[model samples]
Target: MSILKKHPERDPGTAEAVGGEELLVTGGHTFKTLTDKVSGIVEQKPPAQWWLIFVMAVSGMLLLVGVIGWLAWEGTGIWGLNNPVGWGWAIVNFVFWVGIGHAGTLISAILFLLRQQWRTAINRFAEAMTIFAVITALVFPGIHVGRIWLAYYMFPIPNQMLIWPNFRSPLLWDIFAVGTYFTVSTLFWYVGLIPDLATLRDRATNVRKKVLGFFALGWRGGNRQWQHYEKAYLMLAGLATPLVLSVHSVVATDFATSLVPGWHTTIFPPYFVAGAVFSGFGMVMTLALIARKIYGLEDIITVNHLEKMNKIILVTGSMVGYAYMTEFFIAWYSQNEFEVFAFVNRAFGPYAWAYWIMFLCNVITPQIFWFKKLRRSIPVMFVASIFVNIGMWFERFVITVTSLSRDYLPSSWDYFSPSIWDILTFVGSFGLFFTFFLLFLRFLPMVALSEVKGVLPEADPHFYHQKEGDTK
Candidate 1:
């Protein structure tokens, strides 16, 4: 019988039972359903709906290629870099994409440590988003240097000239931080994927089985195999939890260590970290809803799961707002002329429109989640999540452009406007990120099948009596 029909007296919209015991794997999912639903995405042929999205993603990617080609031919001069505004859209884009990448690690690591069961539904999807977003973010700093060919010079190597990158630079710290983040995140994601891959291996035919078997690492599902796997996964989770904080803190250093008025704030580390989580969760919610609809995994990725995610979004969005207010408060409290001017200029200056947009979207928008009805409404949540994403991108732009466009010297001050190439490059990054995401959706198990199964009621060894209806 359907869980819904079985509990006819239960709340119509809820997946829970009469006694209010929450359902984890809903839709009357047996172990077979859990395995089949997840692995089936990979084993089945591509759907017509999936191909439509794939074509669109590829078109965007092609635009990215064309933009990069033009950028390479004409050089950085084609961008909007000028006397005072050197960072322009490149740094803005870099920070925006980096911020979007943070939620995955946070969900996968921190929530796991807290034993949040809801995370199992979304962590795989979020982790994949992180890797793709980081890849898109990496493209900016390399090309922003104007000499893409000399990008290798950022690394420490024994060249004949022996010119090492500036060891003291915060940008150098960014390289270490982001590099380590990507590396550890990949390891963590892959480790989590192994058991799911083993599930795929067991269920597959000849060719598919062989391919998945290789990556499955010869798992026999023995007690020893699980013992080792659990230990390794726990260790990776521990290592990654700290990285979720450290990576963005280092990115903030790229601006905070600078002497620029708005950029030199001491609160940037925590501020950037909060903003990162806020933006990252926004992207996750956006994609999670779409994935839920398209894949018909509504029962597995339930409304309650989404509600929990929105709560996190609300908290982090508020943290970001606190950072914004604190920035203004410190500016006034410090009694520093340039600092005061910077905050004043950000609100009422040339880029005031963007600042207000950021404020409204980041601050005023997410406040809707305060109501339970709005939190459960998918349509409302979808619009709100997109607003948060847009707001975050603007936040980066407002910080990077407004701060640099009007610096200490009035003579060198000029407005920053992105040229055609700059605009296209930024748009192209969305193509790069979504193309990988679409392909991942088509090919991989979107949910962690093994993890989901592990959480099912039957998986408990001590639950044999419950199944037998013995209340001893």
Candidate 2:
């Protein structure tokens, strides 16, 4: 017999039988137990720890709201943008949060298509993370336009102005790409939650049942409901697959379409997509670790799951590093003076410290995953993930700020710095992000309860048939 036998469990989304009874979900649970265990979280009184996290998150959100109101009132003067450096921390944060949103789609859509069973345990939470990250990302662009009221002009409105947005510009492509991605992703997430919501409704108190049932869409576990649910889920997964690639690609075009020395590279689309997955995975790791500890979800979100995500981080990090090298190689090979200056300036210019930090965090830190022992270590993985997040943010900083600060015009070049409002607004987005995340954890089922139940051996009829010695 092989050291690892085929896992007797069956998962609805996974076609292949995985080996090793290493247990994707711990605690021997029947379907009833699984539903109760997950839903009981919402039914129970809030933990002291939960309140502490919620308070901090809400405070940050209040700060974000206050800052946005002030930004609207005071106008763009509160930021550090100037003549040459029109693009500053706002653009950087926008791209940073957008990149951080990619991992959830990758796990929820791409992994599902690939038939990865482990995804069932954490896909719900990951999807929530994606939605919140995108929400944070949308703010920067809205505020960056200076006239917050006029921000709606980016969309095609049948108004008397009759002046449509410049469709030819890649920047405009962002509105379509991100808007579509968010819409589809939200639909996918809500669809997945229906069955679980039904489970919650069945196990809830009278008032709570009404709330859960409203969202549950009258789910009754009938054969027809499961059939339709499966079809809808697969369709959404197929629809979302391309978005994991397209959304960030459109974002990259915003820079690539520009003729700026550092920004004009053709590699931006694929490179940005890779970096997005890298940074998004980093955010997932950061949240997964904290949530697991707080909710005692170590069984559902196992060390193996963490290791798998770490591997993706390492792969995507290497891809980003290669993009960095390719940029330099292209610069040197082309022998273009301005391009060379931009590349060299990025490494050794006034912003060299930021560039080096990006290199260390996005490249060097993730290399720690090459060691299996450290990859599986919670503390090591958590710290490395944090570094990746910081590094990826600085990666955007280096790309956006460094390039614009010292452009082709020698006289107009100037260093970009953030104002107090800029700093506060950026920090406040975190509050908005976590405030939603905490509420999600508190109210919604953090794990996909139905999907997880499907992963158990008892769920597989064939496994029981084999036990009865019935070959057919």
Candidate 3:
């Protein structure tokens, strides 16, 4: 039932045969086999490792909840928000999680629009990661506002007090930007899931069937359904594509609009966008490697898919490095003493340790991918991806902390040190992120079964005719 036969003259070990395109899904898999492999993960009991990870993830999530409750009781006073460095780990984590989400929309929307068939294998989980990361990001802003009860004040809902949220606040902009990004991303992710969910629905019985059947929206895979699905998907993709650029730009605007020396810059939009994609791919690469290895999905996810992601990491990493340099150059060229000091202090001042760590991880680590061997090596990319995220987190730290730690006045300057609450709150956010991701992997098809099938050689009408002609 394999859709593709081995090319007689080609090496069997390679993904590509003589003069053919590289296989997206290897192992000579057919439609049925692919479906069975993906769907079986959800249908069967999760492995022991899954349970262990799930337990850890849930524990982390509980820690987050406990921390939030304590934070609400004690108020923001418990955080390490000093006079100069008012924003601490909370804002750093907010931006980090938001940046972590950009790759999903880029993969799911931008690449799909460009007709990159390779996206089929990874886009589903990438889209899911986007939603989850956004969820995590939203939490920081909510809790950081201090009064969790009055968090609703951020919204423009007509209230008895007639107190309106200042529309000019970047925080308000983030509410709309990230909220829309999350909504469309969830819709895009769900639309992509419909066919695969229906596949699961038909394969399940009793309670599972009813549950999946409800979400599947009666997807029968009929031609009419296919047409409507494709149209809806395309529209959503179009809608989401702009959000990829706009969301991060809005985030950058949070910094750019400020008169703070390090923050005030025109380059932040593109710079932030590049960093977001860089960090986003790093996360996707990390998760994809773990998922494929754990589930024996190598043939489906494929090294080619991973290598492509590495290449992106490299490209965006380079862009991020360039942005770093550009920030310094602008600082120097503008002849502004505050800007110069901000950039200089980031490299050599009190928090220079963090700055160099950011530089090493964000700028230098990904340069390894310039080599083909390293790019394709699983271990290298995995470690590099981890470093990429670490560096990216520090990048935000450097930008946020270094800027505020030393401002216009020398006397008011103070070093920002995060309290234990700051550390626990940030760590707990990861727990929340992983909990959602693990649950998603447990319940949903991580790969888009239908989309992957569409890219297979057999999906072409001429494939059958060509095979027959070759035999003749």
Error of 2 at 182 (Å): 0.8
lDDT of 3 by residue, 88-170 (tens): 89989999999999999999999999999899999999999999999999999999989999899889999999888899988
lDDT tens digits, residues 1-472, model 1? 2233332222223222322457777887877778888888878887787888788878888998888777777788999899888888999999999999999999999999999978999999899999999999999998888777888888888898978889899899889899889899989999989888888888888988899999999888898988988999899999999987999999999999999999998899999999999999999999999889988889889999999999999999999998899999999999999999999999999999999999999999989999999999999999999999999999999999999999898898898888988888887889889999988887678898888877766565434434334453
RMSD of each: 4.3, 4.2, 3.5
User: Which residue pairs in candidate 3 have backbone atoms (N, alpha carbon, C) closer than 3 angstroms, thus clashing?
Assistant: none
* Clashes found in each candidate (C-alpha, N, C closer than 3 A): 0, 0, 0
Clashing pairs in 1: none
**Candidate 1 TM-score to native:** 0.95
> lDDT for every model?
0.88, 0.90, 0.91
Q: Model 1, 388: alpha-carbon shift in Å?
A: 0.6
Which regions of candidate 1 fall more than 4 Å away from where they truly are? 1-21, 469-472
Worst 10 residues of 1 by lDDT: 1-10
Error of 2 at 241 (Å): 0.6
Best by lDDT: 3
